[model samples]
Target: MDVVMRIEQTLDGALSEAEGAGAPPGLAAAMRHAVFPGGARIRPRLCLAVARACGAEDFSAAAATAASIELLHCASLVHDDLPCFDDAPVRRGKPSVHRAFGEPLAVLAGDALIVLAFETLARHAAACPERLATLLLCVGRSVGMPFGIVAGQAWESEPRVDLARYHRAKTGALFAAATVGGAAAAGVESAPWRCLGEKIGEAFQVADDIRDVAGDPDELGKPVGRDAALGRMSAARELGIDGALDRLDLLIGEAAESIPRCPGAAELRALIRLEAQRFLPKELVRVAA
Candidate 1:
């Protein structure tokens, strides 16, 4: 199967396992809502891509790893859109989980998805027991932590914050997990893949900062101008739009260069360039000298 098809199938299967089970119908439905109609699916795609670039022989384990990363991502989005966080009304051009269901259910749904992510990975662990521990560590550290999305969110509550660290944990952790987990799932050394993931994650964060300042909400499928409204630190806010744009381009270039030598290195580089072109603001690209 193709990457997209495999990803969607694995995701659907994972979520379906919850439906009409002993769980409450409403909770099950809410979990489905948060997962379906996913956005770019970039994290999972990158996971599978890295696995392939490393010549993953166990396709099932790789697919599970991809699905697990995507589920954590979806759970994060569900929580991020809550009243306590971004509190946005729309996500992926539709009402957020809290808006569609209630906040209580939304919270449960996110929590359930987090658990489900681990469960999905566990089911495929036997395929490569030697590497399962590494995969679990990568995913766990990305979700929790002194250096994970949870820490990233907590930083907002602190009086002082390290912008780069905050951005990396908040947004970059999972990206790192995706790449690292992909390699680890294939029983390959993952350290070489770390730089690529971190750079890509940072570039994606900067692009998000730019979009929040100047992007159209309709085009973005979510509210824009949130950084300033929330008084959050952002590249666009701290560095100015033009400067952030420059930083984004720099990160994207760095990300491409950071790819480790692999069988499909050229193809992966091209994919990164294509995604950059697709995601980067055309206005920013046009304005750069």
Candidate 2:
């Protein structure tokens, strides 16, 4: 099967665990809202890509690892859009979880996805039991305290923020986990692949910063000017559009170069180049033309 089909099928299988009887109907619906019809499925796609590059023999474990990474990402987005957070009204061009289901359900949905992500991983760990511990540890480090996205979000609440640390934790952490989890699932050394993920993650954030200032919201499937509105640190706000674009270009190049040598190295580089299009945003594309 194609990678997209594989990722979607695994994700569907993961969510099915929540759809059965005895689960809260509202919460299960909310979780489905948070995940279904995803945006690019990029993180999970990255996970599977790295697994392919590393010659994964354990398809079930790799697919589960990828799906778990994406579930974690979906959970973060649901929480990030909460009224207490971004208060984003729409996501993927539809009412956000909080807006559609109410704050209580939104919170529960996000929390549920987090638990479900780990559960999905654990269930599939038996497929590649030898790599199970590392897979769990790698994914765990991308979500929890001190060194994960949770810590990344915590930075936003601090009295002072280091932009570099903030960006790495909030965004790069999960991307690193995607790459690392992919490697571990494939029974490969995962550490060296981290730099590629970090660079790509930072590049993605920079791209978002630029689009927040320059792109169309309907096209973006969310609001624009949010960074400036919230007084958040933004590449476009701090560096100007031209500078942010330059920075994004630099990071994308670095991400491509950072790929560790492997049989699928060339294809991964090509994938990075293709994914970079998502970063460029349509508004900028018109400008460049």
Top candidate by TM-score: 2
Model 2 per-residue lDDT tens digits across residues 83-158? 9989999999999999999999999999999999999988987767788788888899888888789999999999
Residues 123-156, candidate 1: write the lDDT tens digits: 8888787777788889999989999888998998
RMSD of each candidate relative to the true structure: 1.8, 1.8
- Per-model TM-score, in order, reads 0.95, 0.96
Q: What is the C-alpha lDDT of each candidate?
A: 0.88, 0.89
lDDT score of residue 205 within candidate 1: 90
In angstroms, how far off is 51's CA in candidate 2?
Answer: 0.9
Runs in model 2 with CA error above 4 Å? 286-289
Best of the candidates, lDDT: 2
State, as a TM-score between 0 and 1, how close model 2 is to the true structure.
0.96
* CA shift of 150, model 2, Å: 0.9
